[model samples]
Target: MRETKEINALLHLIDDPDEEVFSTVSERIVSYGKGIIPNLENLWENTPDETTQERIELLIHSLHYRDLKTNLSDWGKLENPELLQGALLIDRYQYPEVSFNGITQELERMRRNIWLELNNYLTPLEQVNIINGILYNYYKLKGTEVAYTNPDEFFLHKVIESKKGNAISTGILYAALCQLLDINVLPVNIPRQFILGYFDPNYDVLHAGGNPAHKIQFFLDPMTGQVFTHKDVETYFKRISVPPIPTYYKPLTPKRTIQLLTEELSKCFGSQPYKQAELAQLSQLLGD
Candidate 1:
């Protein structure tokens, strides 16, 4: 009770005209972590000063970003990082108020829909077709043509809520769902583009002396669920005047996928000063 009273008193002191006094108070409140967010939000709602409101907003963002840093560091320590969990951590960076359970349930519903249409007899292409039909045609999820225009398109929760996403977010969702269905879909690290590759599980060991491209069944564009061939990838390289490399056809780990997303997002955050450091921290944690 005494600590609560002390925190409340410090919050009220935020309106003080002296810069040093307010800075001291702000630093003290920030030490309380995300648990103090509700109290800060309530103070912001009740307060009328624009200057004070702005300070409160910055405080809230700092708290959320701090929590994200801690969580992401711990996630990186896992020997096998789960795809959806990493994506959700990225989501929380933007939407601290989002319901984790709600997003999980929503993903579960999508997985069940795909599960209903799948069977052991189905070919890999047929399996992908079912996911395509369900997500794009039935669920009406669409690709954001001007995706870089908005940063929200990169976040998984926002993508789910808006039914719109950029390449990385959509690719992550596709990969996550395929993992749940026991399909060996992986992210293809093609330069200047993000795509998914369906691969044979034993290709790594079986084809150790063979070409990695031989293991790739097909490439799927998560944006439109359009299937393309290796020839198409080569054509893409030719169109861009770049030589194709074997690594481009290889599967990316969950950590690498998130790293790519953050790298792409960093390009868009040129003007946003606050996100720059947080992204740098995340990128370093992911070994970028």
Candidate 2:
């Protein structure tokens, strides 16, 4: 009650004629962070002044954006930030009101379904096949073939809800499920494509191998869960007239992977005039 009273008092000063006084009041109100959002919102509802209402709206947006930056930084600091959680954090930037628990429940349900269809006796290839069947065949999650203008295709929750995504979003889902099931699949940063490579369980990713490509059992296209061999990757490089780099064959850390998702999302906003602010925020987040 006391906090509400204090917040309301500061909010009343939001429309002060003096720029200095209003700035001081605004800074104090924003310092209270997201906890003050409801109070600001309530003040906006009861207040008749258009200027004060706009100030309140700005304060609310500022708080939400601050919270978003904090959450993303925290995710980066986590020892093992899982793919699903990282992607959801990115999703929250665009959907601050989205329910984290609801997203978790939906993903958990899918993970459980994929889990039930496998066992210790299954070979690596067999495991991949089972997950592929469940994800593409049964669930019908298809890729957006040419979603150059579709930014929503990069959000994992949107992908889950729509059953459609581009390479990175779908790859994150596929890799997350594989990790949960103790499968050794990890995302590899293939140029112009996001893909996964099934690693040998005993292969030391952190240490030396004659070639990093040797660490991969095979590659899978996230769009369709289609498996491919090293020879296929080589063929792709030849087709593109680009030389294959060994680093491209290695797995990306969870942070790097999320960065890729954010980068791709920002590019999609190029043609969206109204989304310029969002693109700028994403670019800043990517820089951090």
Per-model C-alpha RMSD? 2.4, 3.1
lDDT of 2 by residue, 99-215 (tens): 878877887888899899999999899999999999999899997663667778988889899999988889998998888877889998677778899989886555756667888
Candidate 1 structure, TM-score to reference: 0.91
Candidate 2 lands at a TM-score of: 0.85
Model 1, residue pairs in steric clash: none
Model number with the top TM-score: 1
TM-score each candidate: 0.91, 0.85
> What is the per-residue lDDT of model 1 for residues 10-50, given as tens digits with 9 covering 90 to 100?
88898889999988988988898888888888889999999
- Candidate 1 — what's its lDDT? 0.85
Residue 240 local lDDT, model 1: 98
